[model samples]
Target chain A: MEILNLEGTEDTPKIILDKKNGIFEISGRSLPEDSAEFYRPVLEWIEKYSSDSNPSTEFVFKLEYFNTASSKLILDVLSALEDIKGMKILWYFHEDDEDMEEAGQEFSELVEIPFEFKTY
Target chain B: MNFIYDLHRTMMSQKLILVFQGDFTQESTKSILSMAERNLDSSGEESSIKRKVFNVMVEALQNIVKHSDELVDGQVRSHAAIFLIGKEANRYSIMTGNPIRKENVVKLKGALDRINGLDKDGLKDLYKEIIKNTTISDKGGAGLGFVDMARKSGEKLEFEFPEMNEEYCFFCLKVNVPRDNE
Candidate 1:
């Protein structure tokens, strides 16, 4: 599939899903009014990429802020990757940001897969 | 209107950093959030606390837009909701009040009571359990916004429901967010 590059907005995140280039990332604030609607296509793309899973998928999420509504959708996106093998997840939080770090921990617990929490 | 001026004075004396009262459309909500960003910036608060305040504000304001009753006290126009963010020492308190349909009061009361009774870990467990058991509401909320707000603020939500009329009651909610080491 072709690259799925979506520019970030004030209330949404930037999405880059390029399987060929080995780039799968979502970053920025994700508090969209319609969380499900905003994340629908991203979920679809990730699922589509599962057909031919990469040897090892490293999905990075550098989120500044995301509300509860977006949290569920974030889980949806992560759940979509369960079928793929050799999938690695990187969750970034700011230094001393306990809330963000805890959020990553929660998401990780739900994922049933270990995630690398990198503090920047 | 002197009453309006008096209201401003009251908020000022109360150390409220931001106050808005009007119809809450999505467009207007964005402006209030941006104004909140600037208000927090001017206070020199840390970025983490600022983000927490913004998240609570977003959830609070959107709750109004989603559930506030249009005909307040049987009036034709929309009921104007009030949003206030006040800072006192290390505590940042967000207070919002709007008209809610009378019929839903009991349901809301039950939900709020359950939320208020939980400790930190209990709140976290309830949040995850609710997510697993409940579908997102038609309004696009996971019924977990209050839980998230409580978890983020590290405080139980304070709320009140004053009967405004036979058809409606004013629902007021307050979430207190703490700054560094507070």
Candidate 2:
């Protein structure tokens, strides 16, 4: 499958899924009216990529804010990464944004993947 | 109107700072959200507090856009809704009302009650459980909107059903998010 690239909107996130480069990232605010619909393809991409597997997959999430619906979709993404080998999730947040930091921690707990917390 | 004075006093006493009453398409609601964030920033609210208010506000607005009764019982409700944000010394309140079919009132109330009854840990478990067990509703709801609001605000969600007509009522929801000092 080709890499999935989507530009972020006011209520969506920027998505970059490149299996060859081993770069999987989704960042920005995700509060889409139809989050499930918006995230369907991303989840499918994860499903396809995990089968082939990458030696060092970097899954990065720098979501400033995401609604509860998007939160579920995010957790699903994290869970899918569990099937991949050499997985590392880099969770990034602003220095003063404790909520985002905590969200990173909470999400990391849902999947048994190596996680790194980065602050800007 | 005759009771206009009372209404003024009510808002003033509550420190109601922002009020928007009209149709809210998803596109228009984005601007309102931006304005609300600016209001919080200018007021010197803490970053976490602003995030909490912003999150709850987004949920409330989205709920209205998704669930408000544009038409109920063969009658159009005009798609107009009301949203207000109030700030006191240390707390912020977000209130929203929209037309809803009377039949949905009970279910919504029950959900709010269940959310209000949970502790922080309980809410977290419930959130994870629901997300794990269910997919989003056609309206893009995982049934976690109210739960997330309650969790972020760290307060019970308050709601009421004011009579609008026989078949539809104004479903009013109010949430209070108290700021946490780091």
**Candidate 2 chain A: worst 10 consecutive residues by lDDT?**
A102-111
Instruction: Spell out the clash pairs found in candidate 2.
Output: none
TM-score of each: 0.95, 0.90
lDDT of each: 0.85, 0.85
Model 2, C-alpha of A67: deviation from truth (Å): 0.7
| lDDT string, candidate 1, A1-74, tens digits | 88999999888899999998999999998878888999999988987888888899999999988878888888
fnat, candidate 2? 0.72
Model 1 per-residue lDDT tens digits across residues B38-85: 878886888878888988998998887777645544553345688899
Give each candidate's interface RMSD in Å.
1.4, 1.2
Per-prediction tally of clashes? 0, 0
